[model samples]
Target: MSSIGGFLAAGLIGAYKYRTRGTMSTSVFLMQLRVAAQGTVVGCLTIGLAYSMAKEYLFDKAPKENAKSLTN
Candidate 1:
């Protein structure tokens, strides 16, 4: 998901920049690639952290709840 988001963002930004510059070159393409790579790393870390926190919050107490219900 993060990679997909980054790719889409990079494509949009690159296209806008290229259009404004009125030229397309290898350097521009490379720059966009770099941007996409960096974005992907950042996005993945952010999304992963959020997922971990959410999972912990949603399920961290399930075991204790189950144990209590069994005793009752």
Candidate 2:
């Protein structure tokens, strides 16, 4: 969640940078929005992948009782 917030902050800063430089027209804002959206999607995917990998590599061999915790 904090990482997502960081990405959002970076996007806002990027937009503000362009706006202050008089380079961010409406089209530029739209493009920035697209970039932010893509960042969010990528972030979510990365989190999912990391969680899966952590479970597989670090916890998959644990006892069945632990596995039940994972499922619920």
Candidate 3:
């Protein structure tokens, strides 16, 4: 999914460059690489954030009570 999105974004950028300058070349491929790198960084950051949030919300918090009460 991320690869697809990155390629789509890179293609858009390349198309824009072609539209303005009328050419696509190695530089455009390099631009695609840069875009893919950006996508990878964003994906890693998102995963890290979600993991941290889930840990904090679930494992790190105090336990909660159920509906039944325990009495002697």
Candidate 4:
């Protein structure tokens, strides 16, 4: 969910930049999309990593019972 949001935000920002730059060439469009995707992936991964670390160290201390949790 957050990854999708990051992609959307990146794409919107790229679109805004592209429009402001006034470059409508195919190459420029593709470049902008590539940059957005790369940025989104990196950002999503970083956030996921940080969240996982925080969950591991700063919050939960009990062993997970996946089966029990799934029935909830």
Which tens-of-lDDT digit does each residue in 8-63 have in candidate 2?
Answer: 89778876866775655777677877887798789889999999999988978865
User: Which wins on TM-score, candidate 2 or candidate 4?
Assistant: 4
Clashing pairs in 4: none
The segments of candidate 1 whose C-alpha lies over 4 angstroms from its true place after superposition are: 1-23, 62-72
lDDT of each: 0.76, 0.78, 0.75, 0.78
Best by TM-score: 4
Count steric clashes of candidate 4: 0
| Steric clashes per prediction | 0, 0, 0, 0
Cα lDDT tens digits, model 1, 1-72, are 966876798689866766676565868767876887788788878999999998899767665553454454
**Runs off by more than 4 Å, candidate 2:** 1-24, 63-72
Which 10 successive residues of model 2 have the least lDDT summed? 63-72
TM-score, per-candidate, Cα-based? 0.47, 0.50, 0.49, 0.54
**Residue runs of model 3 more than 4 Å from their true location after superposition:** 1-24, 63-72
Listing every candidate in turn, what is its Cα RMSD in Å to the true structure after a full C-alpha superposition?
Answer: 5.5, 5.8, 6.7, 6.0
Cα error of candidate 2 at position 43, Å: 1.0
